[model samples]
Target: MVDADWKPSMGFIYGELRKATQEIKGALNDNENAYKPILDVIKEKSSKRLDTCLHMAAYILNPYYYYYDPLAKLDVEADDSIVEILGVLFPGDYELQNQIKMVELPMYKNKLEKFDRPIAIKACAVNNEKFDPANWWDSYGGSAPNLKRIAIRILSLTTSSSGCEIIWSIFEGVSNFKS
Candidate 1:
């Protein structure tokens, strides 16, 4: 989830968690007796790390998963995450929150009005090789300005600054070599 090239989004956090859960379960199934303790530890650590409202908000806002994902909902409560994010975006503004939840959010969620346009619909194509969730919001989210702002801001965040650190280390190595 910490790719530094602007490719990783918070939505991938939940996706990774789900993938790991499935893989661990499947791999452990063959040797349940031997791996039960190990599997339990993995599950505990993963849940502690991956369980967060941020993950839920990202998963819910990312149109790829929110719109097309057929799997059951994540363990977090959707309402709680949405409320928490909205609160952060508009603290002490209950009216705005309600409006977003009632009007703007639903428009995006249901693909209403401009969201239903062919271009917008095509933008949410998760199967596309170059699909960037933030870009999708930037392109098609104009209809819901408030929700659009938060979606773009949140989705644009890099999962990690490690990429920058790696680049800096590489630069340091090159500089030292020159010295």
Candidate 2:
């Protein structure tokens, strides 16, 4: 059960997230030259939970980015680990419980560009059919053409950059499949 009135604030949630990050970082920092053993243990235990936390954080920070991650599935003892920290934000709800998808999407490396604007704006369209340029940019508060031009320009520049090779490759592959 989700709280309909729940509003997520970064400032309110940063402390908890940072604390978790710090716990990992601290463990790594304990032995600057040798973190393999510690990292292995952490990965064996909490990597899945950490990833779920990250995905949940993205969802909380931006409601439009609602996504369900299968790795969030909780074991009998999972709640005991995060109950104290996430309880404040997600009180009464069992977030760590979930079902895993038997099949998964193909993984492609991500671009380094700051696609923040599109990420926040298009989060709702994730994995949806209306994710194309024309459908996505159909709205305009006051100046639709100008916004469209800006988006096009930004996309063009980003694709031309080496950092966005992953994005270009994915687009190329997807487009080829359609044709």
Which candidate's lDDT is highest? 1
Clashing pairs in 2: none
Please report, as a residue range, the 10-residue window in candidate 1 with the lowest summed lDDT.
70-79
Q: Per-residue CA lDDT of candidate 2, range 82-143, in tens?
A: 33334444456543221000111000001112222455354434433333322233332113
User: Number of clashes in every candidate structure?
Assistant: 0, 0
Error of 1 at 122 (Å): 2.9
Error of 1 at 167 (Å): 19
| Collision pairs in model 1 | none
CA RMSD per model (angstroms): 5.8, 20.8
TM-scores of the models, in the order given:
0.73, 0.20
Residue 3 deviation, candidate 2, in Å? 16
For model 1, how does the per-residue alpha-carbon lDDT over 1-179 read when each residue is reduced to its tens digit?
45646475676677556656667768877577766777688768666455577777777788887767654244347546888888888899999999898999889878997789888776776635487888888888888999888888777776766766898999999889953
